[model samples]
Target: MTFPRTLADLSTAELGSGYQAGDFSPGEVLDAVAERIAACEPTINALWHEDLAAARSRAEESGARWRSGQPRGALDGVPVTIKENIARKGVAMPSGHAAGDPQPADHDAPITERLEEAGAIIVGSTVMPDWGMLSSGVSSRHGITRSPLDPALTTGGSSSGAGAAAAAGYGPIHIGSDIGGSIRLPGTWLGLATLKPSFGRIPLDAPYLGRCAGPLARTVDDLRAAMTVIGRPDARDYSQLPPYSGDYRVPDFSVSGLRVAVHTEAGCGMPTDPEVAAAVDAAAQRFADAGAQVTRIAPFMSEELLVDVDRFWRVRSWVDYHGLDIEDQRRILPYVARWCTAGADVPGAELLRCYQSIQTMRQATVAATEPFDLVLSPVAPVAAFPAEWPMPFNDPDQPMGHISFTVPYNMSEQPAASVNAGYTADGRTVGLQLAGRRFDDAGVLAAAEWFERSAEIAAPERTVG
Candidate 1:
């Protein structure tokens, strides 16, 4: 077997089957991946810091295990790329910013350790904007990552390189983190699968932050397989809940008695593009046709809740980039510095107010949507923007303009996903954002799978199975 259209083209089961049959060894797959990375690196600008030799060494070890009939773990030979923000022992884990001291990471972050333990070789670290403060993928340290579909358009950030690499066929699965639309927006722009699980479903531990991290793949099945490997609980991360109960097995997504709220303005001031609105409207009808009750609401969050989430995100920026050296600070993208400074300006009381308001909003959002099982909205206000331009949300004056749809869920700690609804006449993709209540990851994934299977949008070029 050879590389396929998507990194997910060969399902996890198929990869295992290939390994069992001796059709292709991990070394051979690694060679193909290395070639693809070299071939697309110029245009896509995906993989940032890499050690191809290290990746090959791991592949050789995996090949030895396969020959001995003692595979290391579930993703034994799978080549996976991780976002730069997540730590991997001994590898430089710069968050697309110049390092102050550049000290070696003492240990792999919990999620990275889990991936390594499962035998997925860390081929390279994908790039992100400094501290993930910006959403447009441009950073002084790593340059800008462009969309595989159109190099001129934006490849959503700060999980930017993960999406571009996956789209450019570097590997079958790439890990990414999301605080506010980092994963979903990039996935939407690149025409890939992005699963933003409930905040605490996946363990996330780091030197400075605790945002969630998960895989970005070309198919939902691939995502599920990867999640099984990396989404386990870790004592290092206190925010993680216990392993999900098997009791929530999703039945064939029957909308028969399900209540879904369709909120165009997800409790923010941003306006959905006409094309995006039309696509989401059609998707809601499809959900209705599938036998579900769909209701359109003005917005999803309370006014106060929206304000709080925005403030919280801004404050976190200060926490992420504090005490950096001047050169490191200068190496950050303009937008990252802008947000970090904005975060610095937030007073102590305002930050505390935001956290307190989060509780009220969570409760209010839950109560308001008690009658609904799921919520549907646009993933990004527009399909994809120009790569060099600042994202609407990065503009502090337009907090409600860009991240209007995404920030609330981060505050609520819900499970949300972006599915490729359809493409615009100009060829940009529109994503339908589907969200489920806290810990209802299975439900959200099931709903996303339903829509992904229903809508037959073709994956972008240069992806691998």
Candidate 2:
């Protein structure tokens, strides 16, 4: 089928304008996105399900509402995708794990409910690695969700499918959850803009420390659009911040005079790939170029901090794996299985100590970056690895080594993002991590938004020639 790329590739802002101006109908845009998925999915394997029949119905309703001049919300008629772990009524959330319960969720998760209320037509749920653990797309349940930039490369993970879908133009917006670097890691690998807002900024179905659901979009404006809808307090999450009354879409913002810290080393991860390091340094230079007082900052994360958090998560995932029947446990991706299984051997006292180490990391990260208003770092030390590899190095014994730059911010409860800053040798995108103090999500976003508008080159080459 020959669908025009215009409708599928338009950003949320463009869609809104087109819808109001009668340039196109929601149904037409939906068709374009469906065409995009049809063309991209076979090679990418990004989608877990497609609900076009339902989306078509919603698009029809949205079109009629648009014609009458009364739309449901700001995002009325926009196309979006939510990750598989986010429960939607009548759909089973396999969460990329073969052994996961296949029961249909009785109702939509809060993010889904919010998206529906915002009038965005959800095209479908995307894939992820088993149990949302790995930072790569090699899933035991769903197989590999490869990058749009290069089919041979991974999209990064556990937000794997959402990243791939967003990069592939399946839709303008895709919802993803990030505990460590799930959102930003994939965002960087896929050359998209993604945010892991301050903890509790976007209420989660299971709101634990450092875990929040966020969005992946082509532009920060679209990211703000998604935030305006889903970034609210939910009764389901006791940890949610007080309802955010501030406007997410700012008319203007600046980093002028703000203190900026450039962190080149995460202090514990694989040595930053030379290309990635150069890109990050160039990104930080942009802040200096814009009148922000940028300075080099010492690495705050240590081997102890990284190892401690790794131990805590191992025990945490171990508990989940142990609860599943032995046969189900055997179905998990072997890398993830071997990684978490060792958690069973940790002594009770060490387990508590491991948990406390998270608090220690939180304290250290918060203190270290407190002197600066913003911190710029690398999302992952390297660019995208092979699609078939479970981790960057393909080793379960040291799966977390690449996350040192990202995991600290999770524990610190700070808002952070991954914005495409540069390219690898083969033209793959490299992510430059941007972060701000707890609850300063808007500032972090503004910095990212600024980069998007100011970049001299296109961040990713996803356009069809």
Candidate 3:
């Protein structure tokens, strides 16, 4: 039994089957990933840390388990990477900031523990924006994470390296956290599959709002496999939902009777690139052709509501910034510095107002989508922008434009995902977002799988040189 192509090219499910069939060993998979990462790292800068020696040892253990017909679990021998923000035992959680103490964590985040227990080989940590604040990949600590499809383009963040690594085939699964669009934004830009599960679907031990841990993968099947292992309740996260009892396997559901609403703008008259709008429109048409009910709808959120959400996020960043020493704060990226300062003096009344606004926005979103099984929109208003900009707009006055399509769902605490819609004529990748009612994560994933099947979205050609 021998693998004809690079093991890095196989999906997580494929790799699992290959291991079971004795076509390849987990050690071979890790070696293939190391080779690909070595070729791609100079151009992409996707990983911040790696432990190939440890990963190889785990792979050897998994091989022994497979040979004895006592494999530990579903993910045995599968290569996996965690975003920089996640706590991996013995690995420093820098969160992409230059100022944090370099001491490593003594315990694993629940998700990390679960993955390891299931026999997934932990490869390394992926890069992210400073403190996971930015939507693009430039971080003061780890530098920029460029897209594998086109080096000049941004791999959206704060799950920047996860996107780039998944695209470059460093591994089949990556764990990423999303506060606003961290997971989906990068997934869209890098033409990967990612899910931002409903708030509390995956427990997180962080001092932030709307943060949920999720998986970014080359295929929806791989994403589901990772979710099954990591999406369990942890006592550390009091906010986590009760232990999920539902099967993580994407159900066989036809889109024939599904009701999907399409919105190109966030209803605030935000600017959306024509190419992105066209791609989303085509995706909706494909659903319609497949017998689903599709309708173009007005944006569910207003510009003022979006501004308030941005304000709250900035204030949150400000709080985190001030917690660090003044000298350490000075090490933050300029844009992050700007964000921190902008919210430093917000009035208490204004803070309450922002929370009220978020509540209103959530209610509005729930009401608007109640009539539909799923909602379709562009993952972002534009395709991957120039890598140098912190965001597509990068304007201090209107920094939320690129995230208009994504942030609303975060505020709503619903399950949402970014699936490869298609590429623009200029070769930029476009993503179609599928958002479902809160706690309807399975429905959302099923819809994404349907789209993948119907659209036949292809895996990206490896860009490593």
Sorted by TM-score, highest first, which candidate order results?
Answer: 2, 3, 1
Across residues 117-221, which tens digit of lDDT does each residue of candidate 3 receive? 999999999999888888989898988889888888899999999988888888889989898889999988888899999898887776256778899998888
The candidate that achieves the highest lDDT relative to the unseen native structure: 2
Clashes in predicted model 3: 0
Model 2 C-alpha lDDT per residue in residues 1-465, reported as the tens digit of each score: 123456888998899899999999999999999888888888889888889999999999999999999988768999999999998999888878999569988988889999998889999999999889899888888988888878889899999999999988887899999989999999889888999999988887777878989999988888988999999888998888988887764456786898999987888968999999999999888889989999998999999888888888898889999999989988998989999988989999998998888899999999999988889999999988998998898887874899989998999989998788979887889988999999888888888888878875575776331
Error of 1 at 179 (Å): 1.1
Q: Return the clash pairs for model 3, or none.
A: none
- Error (Å) of candidate 1 at residue 434 is 1.4
- RMSD of every candidate to native, in Å, equals 3.0, 1.8, 2.4
> Which runs of model 3 end up more than 4 angstroms from their true locations?
1-5
Task: Output the lDDT of residue 322, model 1.
Answer: 66
Worst 10 residues of 3 by lDDT: 1-10
Off by over 4 Å in 2: 1-4, 463-465
lDDT of 1: 0.76
Clashing residue pairs found in predicted model 1: 6-464, 6-465, 7-172, 7-464, 267-299, 267-300
Model 2 lDDT at residue 125: 93
| Candidate 2 lDDT score at position 187 | 86
